[model samples]
Target chain A: MGKYVSVRGWLECDESTINEVKKIRNDFTATYNEGLLGEDKLELYQSGWTFPEKQINWTAYVFYGADIREYHLDFMKKQLSEMANIQDITGYFLIDDHDGDYHLCWQIYENKFIESEQENIVFNK
Target chain B: MGKYVSVRGWLECDESTINEVKKIRNDFTATYNEGLLGEDKLELYQSGWTFPEKQINWTAYVFYGADIREYHLDFMKKQLSEMANIQDITGYFLIDDHDGDYHLCWQIYENKFIESEQENIVFNK
Candidate 1:
C-alpha cells in the first residue's frame, strides 16, 4: 500500500499579493536547502517555475510517506504555526493519515471561527 | 491578475503510509465542510478516488486567491504544521505569493536539521 496525504484550501488574496508570497517562499526554500546540504544541493531543491500556474491554483498539495506518526504531526503543527506567524495567515486545514487504519483532519479558521466552534462544540458536548 | 501559490516537498515515508494519510485528509476535509456548511458541502470537499493517484505523488499542491498577506502565510504554516503533527510528516516546504511583488518559500525538516542549522548560522553570524 501507499501512504499519502492531501491538503487543500484557499488563500483569500489578490494576484499581486500572491506573486510576492511566491518570491518569499522561493527565497526561504533556497535558504533552507543551502543550510541543509550546503550550496551544492540548493539548485536541486529550487522550484522550477516562477509564477504560480497550472494545477497549483485551487488544487490539492499532496504528501506521501511510510507511516503517519505523532512526531510527524507535531512537527507539522509547529512549522505551520511558525509560517502563520511569519506570514500572518488566517485560516486553513490539514488532513493526514492516522495510525495505520484511520485518518485525522482538522481546520483552523480565524479567531472568530475558533471561538464560535469551541463554544458550539462545548455546548453540544 | 489572479493570485496563486504552490507548496511542494517530499514526505519521507513508504507507499502504504502515503495512502493512509490521504484517507485521513479526505475525511478531515469532509468533516470541516460538514461543520461549516452542512453535509451538502462535504461531498464537494470529499476527495475522489479511494487511493492516492495522478500527479498527487510528486506534484506541488497549489492555492490561489487575492493576496499573500501575513495572515495567509501564517494560516498555511499553521495548517501544514498541524497536518505534520496529526500525520507525523517529517519534511515539507511551502511557496506562496508575498506582498505584491515577491514570493516566499520555507522548509521545515526534523530536529536534527534545526539544531545543526541554528548552530551553523550562529557560528557564521
Candidate 2:
C-alpha cells in the first residue's frame, strides 16, 4: 500500500501567462524523472480561456512516499514563485492512506508581497 | 456581467451508493426547473470506484441572481440529507463577480450523528 499526497490550487494570473505556468509541471517532472501519476494530474479547470475575465483554476495530485512529501512541496513552491504573472495562489493538500481513505490537511494562499503587487497592478490598470 | 456562487464538496459514501447520490442532483434540477449550466456541471472526480476505499469528490458552480442564493443553499441541504449511505459531506462556497473574479467564502462538514453512525457501520463491518 502506498501513501499519497494530493495538491490542489486556485490561481489568478495574466491571461497571457497561463500556458507558461502549466509548462512548469512538465519541466519539473522531466528534471526529477519522477512524474505525477495520471493524465489528470494537472488539469486546468478554468483559464479565463473562454470567458477572458475569470481567473484560472487548477488542481493536481501526486502519489509518492511519505518521506518525500516535503521535497515535493518545496519543489512546487519554487516552481510557483517563478511564474511571472501569478497575482494570487491558493492551494490545499490532501492525503490518501492507500486503504481507501483521504483527508485534507492544509492550505496556503497568496502572501503580502503578492497582495501588494496585485494592488499595484490593479491600481495601475 | 453577473454575480455567481460556486460550490465544492468532498463526500465519502459506500461504493454502492454513488449512483443514488448523483441522481439527487437531477431531481433537484427537475423540481426547481433550473439546471446547472454548461457541461461538467457535476463532475465526479473520484468515487473509490477504482480503489474501493477512496471517498467521492464532487464540485459544481451555479450563476444566478443574488436574491436566490439562499434558496439554492437550503435546497442543497435538503437534497444532501436524503442521501442514504453518505458517511461524510464537506462542502464550501465561492463567489464570482462576473468580472473574471472569484473567491471562496464558506465551508460545511459532517456532524456528530453521522459520525456516530459511521463508526457503528465500520465496527459492524
Candidate 3:
C-alpha cells in the first residue's frame, strides 16, 4: 500500500528562525536520503509570506514519502515546538493513496496539537 | 541567473475536469521533457480539499524549471480559463532567485485575472 503524504504550513519566525530552518534542511539532507533532491524527498519549497497574522512570517512545504511521514511529523514538532509555543503557527498534513483509496487530513497547531478531520475518505485501497 | 518558479492553486472541478488534467499531464509528458518524472518537472501534487469555498474542489501544484515558467503559466491560463470564467478559481505564481536575489509574486484569479503584488523584492541579484 503506497501512500503519498504532503505536509505544509505557514511558519512565523524571524531571521534567526529562518537560519535555523536552513540548517535543519542541510542537516536533514546529510542525515537521510529523504532530503530535497534525495531519494524519498521530492521537493522542499519555502517562501516568506505576504499576508501576515500575528508573528506568522513564512510558509514551508515538506514533500517526502509518506512511508516515513510520521517520523518527519515528529521531527517537525520537535523542531518548531519552542517557537510555536510563544508564537502562532499552523499547518496541515494530508495523506492519500496513489490510486485514490485513502485520504487523511489533520490540522496542526503549535504544540503538536493535531486534529484529525478526515480518514478513510474514499476507501479505494 | 537561474530562477525557481512554483505555480500552484486550488481548482474547483469535477471528475470530468480531473480526467482532463490527467490527460493534460500525459500529453504534456509526451510533448515536453517537463512532465511528472520528466527531466525538468520535479513533482505534481494534486489532492482533494476538505475546505470548501463556493465551487473550489481541488488543489494542484506544478513544480517545474523556471527557465520555461512563463510558457507553463500561459498554458495554465489557457487550460483553466474556461473553468474560471464560469466558476471561482484562483492560484498564485511565486518566483525567486536560487540564492535569494529576487522575489516576485502574482495573484491569479478567474479569467486570467492576475495581479502583480510584488517584484524586485530584493537586490540580491
**Local distance difference test, each candidate:** 0.33, 0.32, 0.35
Error of 1 at A88 (Å): 30
Q: How well is each residue in B1-125 modelled by candidate 2, as lDDT tens digits? A: 23433333233333444455566655654454345432332222111011112332322111111212223444444554554224443333233333433332333344311211111011001
Stretches > 4 Å off in candidate 2: A5-21, A29-31, A34-85, A94-106, A111-125, B1-6, B12-15, B33-71, B83-125
Model 2 score (lDDT): 0.32
Off by over 4 Å in 3: A1-16, A33-87, A98-100, A113-115, A119-125, B1-125
Q: Which runs in model 1 stand beyond 4 Å of their true positions? A: A1-125, B1-5, B33-78, B86-88, B98-102, B111-125
Best prediction by lDDT:
3
> Best candidate per DockQ, number?
2
lDDT of 3: 0.35
Scanning candidate 2 chain B in windows of ten residues, the lowest lDDT window is B116-125
Ranking by DockQ: 2, 1, 3
Query: For candidate 1, what is the interface RMSD?
Result: 15.2
TM-score of every candidate: 0.30, 0.41, 0.33
lDDT of 2 at B59: 22
DockQ of 1: 0.05
Q: Write the per-residue lDDT of candidate 1 for residues A1-125, one digit (tens) a residue.
A: 24434333322223444444455545554555312233532332322222323222343332222222233334334333433432323433434442323233233333111111111011001
Candidate scoring better on DockQ of 1 and 3:
1
